[model samples]
Target: MWLSRACLRLLIGSDVSEHEEAPLIWLIAGEPSGDLIGARLIEALNQQTGTRFRIAGIGGEAMASAGLKSYFPIADIAVMGLIEVIPKIPRIKRRMRETIAQIREDKPAMVVSIDVPGFCYDVWKGLRGSEIPLIHYVAPTVWAWRPDRAKKFAQELDHLMTLLPFEPPYFERVGLDCAFVGHPVLEGGADKGEGQRFREQYGIPPEDNAICVLPGSRSGELKRLGEVFRQAATTVAEKYPDAVFVFPTVSYLRVQVTELTKNWPGRTVVISSISEKFDAMQACDVAMAASGTVSLELAMARVPHIVAYRMNAFTVQIVKLLHGWNQNFVNLVNILLGREVVPEFIQEKCRGDLIGAYICKLLEDPATCEEQMRSVDSALAMLYPPNGLPSDAAASFVVALLGAQNQTNFDKR
Candidate 1:
């Protein structure tokens, strides 16, 4: 009995030592949404176990707030698209090279590359020879368009953590380790019954119809879509004189949007912050938004919306060649329904008059809005994860993989 007790103590001590030996995680979140996910994961990991793992790398405000010491300014690395990146390619390449070199010097146990595949893929390629275990968050939409990129992604990362439930099977078929982390927005809870409150708070008249306009957070996006959005609002207002237009202004582009929409005839209101975004989405009868994650948010709010976006002719052409679909946003409803539940107007098609016409129809016809909402609900039903916080599930998977690697190293040593 004494010998058995001693053996148990020794085993427990070894486990403690193994826990202590857990490698510091280096996280790279290339954009705002990715940074938000990274931040939540960091917080969840800290709470899950008393493990003292140090976090460092490139990310935005959310990651910074969660105690990540960003090596490079995240704003500097926030370039998007193929043609758009050409001008800043040299600067991006230099920053990426520096980041890789720093990672080599630091020799982290693992690297977590968040979204922004254009930059993150390059980072992955640079570090491939270093034998560092990498976990990529938010698998790129190879399934949606570039099915060939799956093979390349399989070769690059040790594991791929996905936000959508449908993504794992596609990666798994290609022999890549992937796990669905559920949608972060779902984990954060839906804004229920807040629509009426939102309208009241914003002083939106209950009798008046409302149209929410989401131009986009990026300056380039706003620049390209602003005039079109304003024009669309004008068209809608002309059709429905009692309609109010609410623009959810992201912090950086508030001034620009205000200056651009100054002379608009309709009652235009620009709001900032997350609560305000939800309030605006809830209060509005219909939404005309840029093609991005915001479409998903509107869907979750059960708001009928039209997704519209415009870019430079070169960028549009390049995307057209690469991607099978010409849709601007990846709305779950659109994907599940296999038809546009929320109509998507891209590039040349994304005009003010067309958008105004669409909004007017959605508002005027109750059946159109109802049919779209039903499709959205069906799509939302498909997005559930098995258990726990999405971030927790992702972190747990990483922790388990790290443990296995540590055990293998210990055995070899």
Candidate 2:
């Protein structure tokens, strides 16, 4: 996706040397998943405009690779859970100030903020009255919890770009300019894996007994599920001695995962590369994963999987108080399906014995595996939007906005 001066000439109808300044846009992504989406969006913008944008914001490795120099590490504000965020509040506030300061100094045409609503909301408030259009990618799940955020978001953000097909209506009902960009995973996200090659490279036997374990990307997730996942793997190994257990994680969390599995009682392997992680998902017979984006990935991969999630007790209480006990499914797949397409063990129910038994049944019984995978396939079918690629759609919106801004400036001149 390298940009050339020739392409720039064709796009802008002028030589790069003759141009005084390129359009600048600020993008902030507070999580690794958001970083991936932001990087893809940046690439889409570059491909559409022939590298006319100067990107500056907060993001991780992927956005950095996409040519954005983040003002600070995204990890500074990546914390989840109510109690977990308390200690980081001061630092988060400081970074928000620093980010607003940079935005004021740069005066970019627009600012796009990816998820992490708490941080992004504060940034929006900081930028209030500046007249910089603040566009938010990945709308909050108000249907699940904090439904009031939708109304507040309509007031704060100028535009909302959602990954889910059903999300636009919720924001639109509250008078927000919303677009349903297809989920990023649906657009060429499933072709990254080489399943057979991954099995051979990792010495995993080509059999129907391999399982993938994903504990999640958060430090709190590892702390909560580490031992339980290890014990579950042990149980699976006991039931099927030939069973292979694979765990894939990001590099930042590799050391924590490795330390968690150092004394594992069964045969297990932890892989850290992005390609290997996707390959493992494709290669596995069934996946036992934390309830998040990986569940959506497994659905996209058509891999049979079960999910589990646990949060701090205080945070759980807060959720119950805010959203109430009527909320059921935690996994995105199940929530989208409106049924238990995949079994979920959450909070106190997130136990190794129960999750292992379910895994064992799926591994031994082909019918069970087939049934679960079919449900996943059905739910995945609902995520596709009318547009072809979400990044392309999002980039088109940004480009049009930038062009309008240029026109306004020329008219003023």
Candidate 3:
């Protein structure tokens, strides 16, 4: 029976056998941002090795375009927040179990989990005893909100790949093996010209000083802050009649933002593409944005901006109860710099009038805008290594770890 099964497997040409020469890297990315990062890493891995590696797991269209074969629909797992995920727990668990079963049966060389801590951590836990090396891309916000999760993550992952420079030190302090991959944004050049062209393309007057408003990509976020953002823009328009408002809308939320801001009198443009987003950011004199990765992108673009965030009342209250930290993550970076380089407004303080007032101040005062831009330059300089070797350095680290493990196995044989 065993011989017959082996012969049948050989005759059928198993999918696993095709990948015998190169390692099978199982990549799981749970959001659009993570999917983009995973695609870049996939390209880097292929370039570094000069051999085609088989990538299989869950990722969206971007990763699929980069040669990743999905085990299940990636969008199914793209969930957020504790309260939002409760209804989908059973479905998520089923997916996790299926993933673990595949790992055990096929035995991939490495499991690379990117972002989505809640789901990926469960997958890691299920496959804890497997020989497969675990690599987690984009360290969780353990540094900020929950430091204790660091030790648990350290125990599970063989290596943690970080996008931020400050992340490695924090993970290392908790005894995790980690590497800082300079942000992908830096790898893509920052062109101020793109910003100007975007304004022109969007029919925004070149003479007008535009302020970009990015509420967030999520529907819930738009619903929460859309009215406030529109009101803020109206106030700014009143202060500076020449000021135009630009919104680099995520494709998914375009309709929502449009519906919300229909009554506003100011000229507003919503751009969806990556190129357009970069251009919009550059074209704007200042930005009023939600506190998220977009803020980092704006900073990298050298745009002076104000950051704000609004969450469910229940969630905010619970967070306040559990964490005694006075400031949210938006202002935390500025606080680390020892000055208010980027002003932050949150909760009730994130009113339209106040945000509008602050933005008006920044736009009118060239000195203030320059000061903020200087701080952005300083922050980016500190974040990246001297030679701009973040992508190459990170890829080398992952390849070396895999090589070392293979060598150890051969030695044992």
**What digit string (tens of lDDT, one per residue) describes model 3 on residues 146-229?**
667888898888899887777787778877888877666666544343876676677777778888888888887787777787
Report the lDDT of model 1 for residue 209: 92
Backbone clashes, each candidate: 0, 0, 1
Descending-TM-score candidate ranking: 3, 2, 1
Each prediction's whole-model lDDT (CA):
0.79, 0.82, 0.75
Error of 1 at 183 (Å): 2.4
Q: What are the candidates' C-alpha RMSDs?
A: 5.0, 3.9, 7.0
Give lDDT for model 3.
0.75
Worst 10 residues of 2 by lDDT: 8-17
Global fold similarity of model 1 (TM-score) = 0.86
Candidate 1: worst-modelled 10 consecutive residues by lDDT: 1-10
Report how far off residue 233 is in candidate 3 (Å): 2.0
lDDT-wise, the better of 1 and 3 is: 1
lDDT top scorer: 2
Candidate 3 positional error at 132, Å: 1.6
Better of 2 and 3 by TM-score: 3
Candidate 1, residues 166-271, lDDT tens digits: the string is 7888788888998887778765534553778878877888999988888888887888888888888888888788788888887878898888779775788887
Instruction: Kindly report which residue pairs in candidate 3 clash with one another.
Output: 195-279
**Which regions of candidate 3 are displaced past 4 Å?**
1-20, 188-193, 312-314, 323-329, 332-338, 385-389
